[model samples]
Target chain A: MQRTPFYQKHLDAGAKMVDFAGWEMPIHYGSQLQEHKQVRSDAGMFDVSHMVVLDLQGAEAKPYLLKLLANNVDKLKESGKALYSCMLNEQGGVIDDLIVYYLSDTAYRIVVNAGTREKDLAWMRQQLQGFDATLTERSDLAMLAVQGPNARAKVFSLMPADEIAIAELLKPFYGAQIGSWFIARTGYTGEDGFEMMFPAEQAEKVWDALVGAGIPPIGLGARDTLRLEAGMNLYGTDMDETTSALTSGLGWTIAWEPANRDFIGRQALEAEKAVGVQQKFVGLVLEGKGVLRSHMKVTCEAGEGEITSGTFSPSLGLAIALARVPVACGEQCSIEIRGKLYPAKVVKPVFVRQGQSVLS
Target chain B: MSNVPANLKYADSHEWILDQGDGTVTIGITDHAQALLGDLVFVELPEVGAQLTAGDECGVVESVKAASDIYAPVSGEVIEINHALEDSPELVNSDPYAAGWIFKLKLDSTAELTGLLTANAYSELVAAEA
Candidate 1:
């Protein structure tokens, strides 16, 4: 099992340990619900350095990214601009979802899920084999995701004045480097914060500094709940290679314009667009009593679909889930719990974002 | 360190069985279980009058972190259950030994209780796993 640089910090915080994507990671410091709320109301930090960070460098980086990624690379015109997109197979099925950073004209940085790192790298390498691209995996970097309504202020307060000034100038979806540390205004949690990446050896110091600055050290347990509340998709749980982005509530991320640029999965997506997709992904809020769980059956007249990801949303004060169901399904469905079924209301995928309840 | 409380026998699987002494045994998951499970969200208990064998799956305990099976440590029919948990499941985290008692069983045989580990033994078992 791989241990991140912040492993000792988690241990010191008395965090409950669990295996995640082959890494021994912290599930919680103490109470996952409390941690979830802390990230919503106050400031919290998560060590997400386990996710692979790969730098793609070479002359053909732009054209390669334009072909390999589904989202428009034009969205990242400025250097250091970041964009989230899905790397797809030819069938419009998602191979891996990634965040790409336009580091330079000839250089790009991409971060992918830890579980799909090997496959993502292999696929990227194969695609770039014809192009002259160099893939360098940055295992020496450690990333900390500081998120919440108060997260940015707290982090900015602790940063060196010059670094803070530089970071403050960075808009959302953009990154700036101060020394070896890279700061970006992007996060999985529905909050304003930075995903800061620094040298692995410098992580413990920064973590202690964040703790000293009163940012709660959150773990994977609350991380899952917070992201789910924000209507974010988790790799392997909410989606995998077998699923299509169209059915995974990722239609908006697919760029189908400019009719001539043939990207991977373009044909299948165009076919699905012409014929209409069969299944649709939606969020469910448990109105009746019961906690929703992954793989629990979601039922309606249209058919039975299983929950891709579900949990008690601390922000919503109820259980919420993302389920892939038939397009013909009703707004209300029942989730089978133990034996009896509980009714749930289907709503927009995002229950909350930027710490605000989208439903309310 | 002993927020776990005394005066209760515990099963290695985390069920805490309190001997009512009159014949019935009140059972609940331990504080350790609640601490391990994080936030208590939902629970599904066996219906009243349901007979269960030792180690039978009588109920489900779900925390915000994960869902787990609550096994019966003593064989008997469930005489009563904590109906309070239906709405306020966090009682298991707040008071696992008292208000969080999952069910009361009419013991078929007292000998079955002997096999259950004591609170100290249960703690030791947990320590070994840790």
Candidate 2:
């Protein structure tokens, strides 16, 4: 398995390493529950260097992105602005969900999920045939997400004198290139923090500095729970090549306006919408005993469905999940677990955000 | 390394059985098993009056990572279960050998205890898997 630049740091911290997307990454240092609570309550850092970072440049970069992503890139009017979008196939199936940062008119930074790196690159390269844009994977960089309610303040305390001011002024969903570092006020966990992308060689030093500053290192196990609690869709678990963005609780990310802008999956998505979507993705909270798990059958008034991603929410101290049920399944459903059906309440996909429960 | 108390008997499936001297015995998963499961959030225990055969699936331990079935190591009648796990499942991770014991069973036959592996044999079993 491949190792990230911070592999030694993870080992030194007593992390239990596991194979994730062909990379040997930390699952947890010791207690996954503690690491999860730390991120929700305080600051925690994650080694996210395994994610693929590509720099797209040349004059046609903007236009290329416009046609490449389902969401319109034209909305990113200012440099440093970021947009969450899904790269879909011709049939409206999501290829991968990604974040694209507008750096300049001719340059943009795109980060895609690690597991889909190879295919995403291949797809993007194939589409670059006539366009002048050049997509270069930045293997020379490392990414770290420092997240929590106090994440931003803690990260700023470690910034060098010259970059500290710029880092402080960065707005949410914006990134700034300061010296050799690209610090973005964004994160997978629903908290205020920076996704620091910097030179790969400086990874260990950066990790040490953060540790010295008392930011606990978090692992992928907590990362999953954090995102799930925030109602974020995990690329492979929540949606894949066979699933459409419309059915993945990501319909809002699609830019339906300016109907003339024909993106890759526009025709198929419009057709699916015209026919009336059969399945709708929503959040589920188990009202009874036992933890909800993936692939569990969900029966509702409309029909039966299956859970995409499910786990015990440490924040709410209950089992919560993301499921795709028949569109007409109202607010009540029963989930089958171990041959028994348990009642569950269907709610908006978001169960928690900003360290607080948003459920009604 | 996992704790394998010399006095407690073990099952190949990772359940540790402690003979309470009386007709009943207490059982729970081993330390290694709990570690492998990570932090447990919920546990489904068998009812007190339920009768279970050897190797029967009687309960489940659900951690954040995955859910694992708890099997009956020996034929027995369930006499008691740890109710604390329903609200605080982490007790299994924190004290697997003591307060974390899952259920008490009235052994169908004391001969079943001799069929279980000794602490030394259980240690070897875990080491081999590692």
Candidate 3:
């Protein structure tokens, strides 16, 4: 199994390790529930070094991305600006969900999931045929995500004063560079934090610094729950190459304002918009004594749907799940738990944001 | 980890069997099982007075992460169950070694208990699985 720079740190912290997407990663530390609650209530850090970082260089990078991504890249002009886009198949189904950063006029940085690294890289390279783009895979970089309300203050305390000044004013979905280190005000856990990228060789020192600063080393178990509570989607579980962004609660990332700018999946999405869609993603809370789990059947008065991701929500103190079911499925529903169906209530996701319950 | 109470016999599956000693055995999941499940969100206990064969699935323990079945280590009649788990399942996590015991059974064939691995063996089993 491949190991990241923080593998030893995770081991020293008494983490339970698992093979994830070919990388040996911490699944949890001690108790998953305790770690899940810690990230929700306090602060945490994640070694997301397994995620692939690809840099696009060459004058035609912008136009290349315009033709490649479902979301437009025209809005990103300033250096360090980040845009969340879905790389879709020709049929409008998502290939992978990723974040692209505008590093320079002729350069951009993209971070993708570890599982889809090879496929995403191959697809991007194949599409760069006409463009003068040079795709540089930065396997030598390590990513660390410091997340939660206090993440900024904790991380800023460890950063050099000059970088902290620029980082302090960084708006969401934006980033700034400090030499080779790229710190972006973005994260998967739906919290205010920076997904910082630094040289692989220097990552252990930064991790030690964060450790001394009181950021608990978090694992993938907490990562999953945090993202669920924040109402974000997991790439494979929530939406994969078989699902489209429109039905996956990712329509916000679609740029339709510039109607004239045609992107790769625009035509297929337009067709779906015209004909309407069968399924819509929604959040669910179990009303009975059952914890919702992924792939559990969700039956509403209108139709049935399957849970993409489900777990006992630490923030809500109840079993919560995200399901993709027929559209217009209403308030009351049932989740099949162990052959028997139990009651639940459907609601919009975003259970918690900024450490507070969005729904009361 | 549940006390494994010196009086009760356990299966490697994480179930504990309490010998009611009158040709009957009381069965339930162990504290280790409950802790592994986490946040006892749900319990699908078997029906009272239901007959079960050794190794037959009797019920389920559902946690926030996933669901696992509670198996019958010995064949018997399920005489009683903890209905309290249906309302507040956290007892399984809080006092699984004691009050969290799942169900009671009247042994049909005591021979089934022989196949079960002891508490010490079960502990080793979990450690090895990890």
- Evaluate all candidate structures by whole-model CA lDDT and list the values in order: 0.88, 0.94, 0.85
lDDT (10s digit) by residue, model 1, range A1-360: 989999989999998788998999999887888898899989899999999999889888888888998987866778789999999999888998989888887988899999898889899888887887788999999999999989888888887798888888888889976899888899998888889889998888899899989997999988898889888899888878889899998888888877777888899898987998999999999997668889999999999888999998888778899999999988899988878788899888889887788985
**How many pairs of residues collide in each model?**
0, 0, 0
Residue ranges of candidate 3 with Cα displaced over 4 Å: B1-7, B22-26, B30-40, B83-96, B109-111, B119-130
lDDT of 2 by residue, A197-313 (tens): 999999999999898888989999999999999999999999998998999999999999898999999999999999998899999999976788789999998899999999999
Residue A243, candidate 2: how far off, in angstroms? 0.9
What is the interface root-mean-square deviation of candidate 2?
0.9
Q: Highest TM-score among the candidates is held by which one?
A: 2
> Interface RMSD (Å), each candidate?
1.0, 0.9, 2.2
lDDT of 3 by residue, A158-273 (tens): 87788888899999999988898889999988788889999999987988899899898988887888899889988999999889898898888888867877788888999999
Which residue pairs show backbone clashes in model 1?
A: none
Residue B36 lDDT in model 1? 73
Q: Considering just chain B, what TM-score does every model have?
A: 0.95, 0.98, 0.89
Expressed as tens digits, the lDDT of each residue in B39-108 for candidate 2 is 9999999999999998999999999989999999999999999999988889999999998999999999
Instruction: Assess candidate 2 and give its TM-score to the true structure.
Output: 0.99
User: What's the candidate order when arranged by decreasing TM-score?
Assistant: 2, 1, 3
Determine the backbone clash count of candidate 1: 0
